[model samples]
Target: MRIDLTSVFVDDQAKALDFYTDVLGFEKKNDVPVGDARWLTVVSPEAPEGPELLLEPSGHPAVGPYKEALVADGIPAAAFSVDDVHAEYERLRAHGVRFTQPPIDAGSVTTAVLDDTCGNLIQIMRVA
Candidate 1:
């Protein structure tokens, strides 16, 4: 099966939407309410608009643990491929993005990590 979607847990959906759209430049794909929360998704301009990142809630018990563990470890953010890591990094920084890790050579790929200002870090990467 093709990898059409991935998820990033957020404390709030509305806040996450602003960051993803306003800061990251990802267009909103859909916002479907599924019970107490919503099934929010966004897609990059480069992508076919089919694959989107599911912005799920961290309030649920099942995902709360997983989300906390990842955030606590200070691991890299959800990796997103960019045409030019350096350029993209600069663009984001100019937009007042707070970066925890600057763009650096990662052997095969150059990557950078930044806080989404919501709850989790976000990663931007490019092929080396």
Candidate 2:
């Protein structure tokens, strides 16, 4: 009935942690050690009790190919809502974020895609 947590496969957990928190501004929620990988999760600062994003490791056999295919096709692994797509894009760009696609209107919304640098493309969008 409701979403609690979601995940995106990451090539490296440490780098993803820095980017998701230091750059994108998400707050760290959990960091439990799970064998070789940690059960790391982050939550939006605006809604600390909202759904959490799990930065899962891409060590599984199928994950590498799946991520590669998605990137090759210019697809975003996750989409985050923003107040202003263009403004967010600009702000992120200034912080050295590399966007695969700049903000563009698409019918009812505007979106921009940026590489997460940990092997995933993420999209920031605003409803128009």
lDDT of each: 0.85, 0.97
**How many residue pairs clash (N, CA or C atoms closer than 3 angstroms) in each of the candidate models, in the order given?**
0, 0
Per-prediction CA RMSD (Å): 1.8, 0.7
- Pick the lDDT winner: 2
| Model 1 alpha-carbon drift over 4 Å, by segment | 62-65
Per-residue error at 97 for model 1, in Å? 1.1
**Clash pairs (backbone) in predicted model 2:** none
In candidate 2, what are the lDDT values of residues 1-128, reduced to their tens digit? 99999999999999999999999999999999999999999999999999999999999999999999999999999999999998899899999999999999989999999999999999999986
Worst 10 residues of 2 by lDDT: 84-93
User: How far in Å is the alpha carbon of 32 misplaced in model 2?
Assistant: 0.6
Query: Lowest-lDDT window of 10 residues in candidate 1?
Result: 62-71
Candidate 1 structure quality by residue, lDDT tens digits, 4-99: 889988889999999999989899998998999999999986774578898888886777666567668877548888889889889999999998
